[model samples]
Target chain A: MTTIQLPPLPRVAPALTCDPAAISACGADLLAASAQVDDLGTFVAGRARVDDWTGEAATAYHQAIAPTGRRADAMSLALRGVAHRVEEHSAEMQRLLDRRTALEDRQQHLAQQVAHLRAEVATTTEEGAAELQADCDRVAGQVQAYETDLDTWVSDLATEESEMSQAFTRVLGADDVDRIYGGVADPADGPLRDKPGAGASPAEVHAWWAALTAAQRRAVIAAAPGAIGNLDGIPASARHAANTVALGRDLADYAHTEDAGVLTDDERTCYDNALAADEARREIEGRHDPVTGEPIVAQIYIYDPAAFDGDGAVAISAGDLDTADNVAVVVPGFGTDGESAPYQADRAATLYESTRVLDPSATNASLFWIGYDAPDNAPWDEGYDGAGVVTESMAAAGGERLADTIDGLRASREDDPAHLTAIGHSYGSTTTGHGAHDHGLGVDDVVFVGSPGVGGDTDHASDTGVDPDHVWAGSNSRDPIADLGNHGWVHGETVFGAGLGDDPAEDDFGAHRFQAESTTRGGAYSFGDHSKYFDHDTESLANISHIVNGDYDAVQEAEHLHDPFLGPVEDPEYDREPTSPTTSSLTP
Target chain B: MEVVPVSVGEASRAWDEQHLDLDAAATQIADADTSGFTTHVRGAATRFLAQWQRHAEGLGTVSEQRADGLRTTIADYVTSDEATRGDLVALLTYTQEVR
Candidate 1:
């Protein structure tokens, strides 16, 4: 007989005397009360009622029902997000259990086959018995494989089980379950609300979150998981659990739209972007660091995928960002999304491991933040608006989002705020540069890897608002992309907003230079080469890790002179060049 | 029980190939993978593959922890998500286009 466990259902607040309809009724009652007060005030105003009973404040008093009126909509979003998430968790748990049961059933079937073979072997002739024994041997292995499968299934189930437990009230005593279901009397005192600045600052969110009881917190999560998950200062686990719920709903909607077969082109794009975001979440969760044996701390700090004309923004962390002692956020250059995100995450894991190698005891979280829509990945258009297409304007546009992400991370940080470093690769370096140069993101260090250029007007490391000393750059001497930045710097600022400053690798650029491997083919590195600054065996990767850990002295210096006269070092493996600036209209 | 030595480079390539195939085959599963007993099997398979990917990678960095990790991957793979019952076979048809 197999043990069959049903999926844990959503916690039923037995005392939820307020279903959505009931909540609306309550709001309606409040509205009615307010109107009655208004009527009395009107009578007083007209002097048609009692003396001195002027209803001067009656109309204003009636406005007290506004929050109640708004609560219905807010509660709906919350309930839907929670219910969908609970359903996902339940479905996953049940699946794991069922799969395990299937394996066990297979195991039993094989075991019975082996048993039958053994019985036949006892009764059969020598030749038949030998064949029967061989059958038994094969069947025996199947039984063991099934047994092993079951063992692992149980272990994996624990992870889902634990997540579900947090999502629901698994550890609660019967009395506590009754009380949890009974629910809190006044949700107004709860942490969720749409106040003037409900999530304006991490400190405020922290304070509000701290004031709630466990049950209240659970209730708030159930009602508004997305708001809570997106909220600053909440713990990583809570946010992940909450966001998972929101994501499930979004995915379901996406699936539904697809099923309906009426998705607009825009909706199709949104679906792909949403799918990418979902995959990114999965990446951060079970993956391990390339260097460290520790479980990767995947946190979805921000997941606004449908923002900015279908180019969504997302931030994923490899470790707990809120509590870590050191954090580095990598903004990918171009063509980054759920699909391209694994590469960026791979870079983060590499950097994370390198940091540990640099400082054995450092608690770190490296984030792959594709939090802004970069230039679209496509060939240049008909007219190459040198300034408009793939210009620093894209970075300039993305500056605020980058700033907000850092600000949110900063706000959510625990006591003794983490030493944070922001690094940008390829075009992302410009975005990072501008985020500092323009938006004033507070970071301990800023590193530019394979940068196309900083802004046209911006000169020197200090321009990025990072301490000039902490400004860092790494570009392979043979890297053509870095070379393009050198050309723009050498060409002088061409288009006002489009132009980028001098090459940070140059001695004149004033950035502390680091070595990068230019060994893809010969000594020269091209566009494809530009993408591998964090690849294994590259000195650039080690230097980046050192910078993140604040081990400045350990950072390696560059090799090979970058004089314009240095010319092409050798034939590149994949010598792809950017289109001429005059005719170019590309975004990637 | 039939263990394929999860060589990191090969496994990484496997992951990329699997994703590309899944990207192409998603519609078939997305239509029917929403509910029913099959969904449970799919979810288990999906999660197990996640664990398996992790376990395969762990073989390099933390081979000592192999037993625990491999157990998860093997089980999940048994009930893993597929476009059809022959998802793995279909995946085999797609070659690794790039590294």
Candidate 2:
């Protein structure tokens, strides 16, 4: 009979000598350097477009500078590739080190057990000795198992190091740089050759993006930032980078042309739009994170300075959309455009803070999505033109774009979906209503605040493609715009008959109406209350934050508008105490 | 020779300004920090930085040369214009005397 032999136990687990912090720091340094190089490249490209300088000397200057700009771009790409690999390597090393520490602790415990078992065997008598010996053998087998695990762990560490080295070698190769970024002077000729068609769904765009290499992504961003900056399926970080680059380039080019006195009226409008976008981004970036005191992240998710006939389109998010646990998109109504987006971003930031204050552990993101062309003028303005007239056609068109954006958000986060809420204010509520009723805006909840209407065809919450129970509305009693639907009554008789649609705050509309009243201003018919729903220290903002955090029970319910002829009429709640004591007395 | 519709002073100033910009750019590139990378990555980055610095210096040198050439050309054009004006004035005076 043959006995199976067990290998001797390892005395100790292998040590991990690499410092993950140092590795991570190095990665960060590489990224910083890469950004600097990219800036230099942009500067060179702008300088090369010296249209005012003419003749043979000008041609020679352009020819000399163009190649240098291209080289800068290639160098930037190479550094970024290396930085990405280094960061990934650092993360993997950290994970491996953690595993190694746990393994070492286990081995130490087993080694102590072996010593105890051997001591017991030495001190026991004949029968006890046999039992002790068996215990020793069992411990020995465990040690052998531990040895095998350590061996595998050590091998894995070596393999990881080898793979990292190989990756660095490939990223740093001169030929590799040329092959990736050299040929793509114009993005259309290189990385963007296989770009998905405009009609492609967000999922298809996401798939196409995921298939590209790091080098390819860098090339695309360097070559054609404007093309992909507003593309729906791209990640928020990438979009932010691309948009920032595009904005910088445009500002430089336009400023140069303006200096030369050759800027067209259209170019001036676009330049103003770009400036507004930059201002919004700067304002959001200046805000601090509620929990960490770090600067809050702001992403320019939509930036088309020339869209909507120079009224332009822009959307800014106040947090990291990709990783947030809850995301709230606040859509604005009439009189909002690129110029007013900075103010809208402030509301988004306020909502983000309110959500964080309510649930400190939950990660939240909020966006001021002015992605659609709202009526450019307020209806109440003097000599109001019919161009800003409330019409169903504009709402219908806006709804299509809104639906596409929401769908894109869902598709981009399929692996880990956030609890998304869409809040529409004033005429924007009509757009959101049509988006839900016509295109099925798939969201966890839909909110209409101070709404003029929901939709021309939507009569009930159920028709908005969301569960009737999940539909919510906030209409201050003093808000005049909130009464522009079937809910408005005159002398106990319905005066406004579903012109835009049934008011979302109407009892028959089947939506939960939340208390929304002006806290600072008191009056029965203050038109100013129409725009105060998002003000801090107000019930409206608090209740909206609760819904966004998915704390449905915490939402304070208000009586919906009902006819006085039927029974005792219910007046809207007013002058309620603010939900949080730490609320700031800031206007929206 | 082709007649160039060039503003000589403006063109010369522009070349001089470009030369300054190219020199500043080259200096910035040279001053970029390439340390803190992993051993192999550091080596690669050092090599790339060196190569780029050389290229930038080359561009800066060329820009300086262009500026110098433009300055000399501008001086020559000014001198030749003055000489031609003096000769024209002298011939006009001679014709008036003959009349």
Candidate 3:
């Protein structure tokens, strides 16, 4: 087995300030200084202007001199007000620096501890190796624990800064603070903030949003875009509008920051994702309809950077989810990101197109969910991540994310409920399977293609939460990567590193198999790759589109494999024959 | 003010990553060839691999019930990408028609 090289974990954020006195003093000083300035900066100007003049000539001189002096005085006051703000910002920066120093000191202490432990281990006898290993593991876990805590501290600091900006805005215009929060009456202690739309139930969210005035709604969209951008139970149009503004503004900011080389690694990733969001936007802008190459209206439901380790979470809909009768969520497999978003978008577009073809009046939207870390990433390998496609840990985690995403989608729907079908391809199938198996994934139907496994102990389609008949599986006969999941064949009882779950196509998995043309090299057991499941002139894509649109009858059944003993089996599709395969590409 | 479970899901991932993180850092324990520190680790891994192998064999019932399904799956395996075959060597040995 080959070993992978890994970099040591490094701390990413400064420690939180424990000096409440200093922080409180800074806040008090900023508030007092800001209050010291009159709202219009007119006091100095009034004091500087002359009251009267004696002669006509003197009057003209006084008139011009008085206005000029008044203007200059106002300008001076404004400059001073700005200078006071600068002072407060500078003070905040110093506090941050102080916190950083503390964090660095702590880190130094840990580093010394690690070095000491290493020295002790170096002289240990063979009998103590196990003890040393345990010690090292404990120390490393501690280091990781520190990094995690630091991230939380960083998150808190960011929140503090946002609140501070709100506070600053209040000082600028207390009367207009309502507008600044996008109609949130009082951002910190207001109806919207008291019960944020994020985690509220659908009815509650809708009710809260409905109670707001139109101007208030617009204000919320402006000031707290993320609040409405990702909140459940909001209209898709509203979310799209909010996200569009946010995307454009953030991308512009990121572009400048990235070009200046001032972005951290996570910030750089966010920058790339912003670009990807723009690319998908362009795709929607370019398309006229789901199938036709023309312009169409759409929504960018969510674009979050704070969560999921900056891999970020995004959902793009080609049609309005609230108005549509059908919604298809396409969960992609390994190596999915903004760079590959356009391709996934294209696939989504095609699914939308297929749904249209299947039914003349079927209103549909297709969404691409690349929200989770799919697997150990590589370029779009025919098999997932090339030689690194050895672990299902990522898929397992992605399953939970997928489950939550589906729940969010359901909660976000407006008007009448839409029939939602989740579709997954390759390792994505495994991710979805686990979602269904573990997370009570709420969906109407599920379809799988080029799946490995979902997770352990999921023996039937019903076990995945969806009805057995509603669970669909499609795999190309010549495809070689499908079996790596080890779902199709027998295995030793003690097999470790199993796929996410049982194969949905397996007879006992109780999934409906649909026909798909082989997208592999013409071979019995040789060199076919994954990724061709969506190729045109194939039955798989046709079946997947049909499933999404609820055109179940239109989905073609797989070819009879002619089981020599059992005649022919139906439901999940299967390959025609087996031949010897070379173990060339799948070594550690 | 509120501390939700941020580490709830991440804790497991961190443990899983130790193979790369801790193993690489403590090459003294991971690289068994010249390192006494790795002896315990190598033995533990072997035990795990062997134990899971037994768990994998419980599929004897599945193989019989879905022989034809397994046949087509095996066919796909033969024709599919060769990159993942070695990973399934144990299954292949267990499921081949002769066996």
- Best by DockQ, which number? 2
lDDT of 2 by residue, B1-99 (tens): 111223433434444444443444344444545443345445654665455545444544654554465455444444454435544443232221110
- Candidate 2: TM-score? 0.62
Candidate 1 CAPRI assessment class: incorrect
Specify the poorest-scoring 10-residue window by lDDT in model 3 chain B.
B28-37
Alpha carbon deviation, residue A198, candidate 1 (Å): 7.6
Residue A375 Cα positional deviation in candidate 1, in Å, after optimal superposition:
0.6
**DockQ, all candidates in order:** 0.01, 0.07, 0.01
Candidate topping lDDT: 2
Among these predictions, the greatest TM-score belongs to: 2
Error of 3 at B43 (Å): 79
Per-residue C-alpha lDDT of model 1 across residues A170-190, encoded as one tens digit per residue: 212323322343332335334
Off by over 4 Å in 3: A1-191, A197-199, A259-261, A290-294, A305-307, A376-389, A488-494, A518-529, A559-588, B1-99
Per-residue lDDT of A1-588 in model 2, one digit per residue for the tens?
222222245579766667765676555444444544555466566643556556676577668667666776776666666656767778988888888998989887987786666566556776565566567677778887887888888888777777766655664445676777774553323557788988999898888887888767765664567768888788777777667656655654455456646567998989898888888887888887776677778988898889888878899899998999999999888778778877898898888887877777899899998888887676566334225435656677888999989988887888999999999998889889999999999799999999878886788899998999899999887787877665534211123322566788988889999988765555666778888888777788889989999999988889888856666435556545435333342223
The DockQ score of candidate 2 comes to 0.07
Tell me the spans in candidate 2 whose CA falls farther than 4 Å from its real position: A1-191, A378-386, A488-499, A564-570, A574-588, B1-99
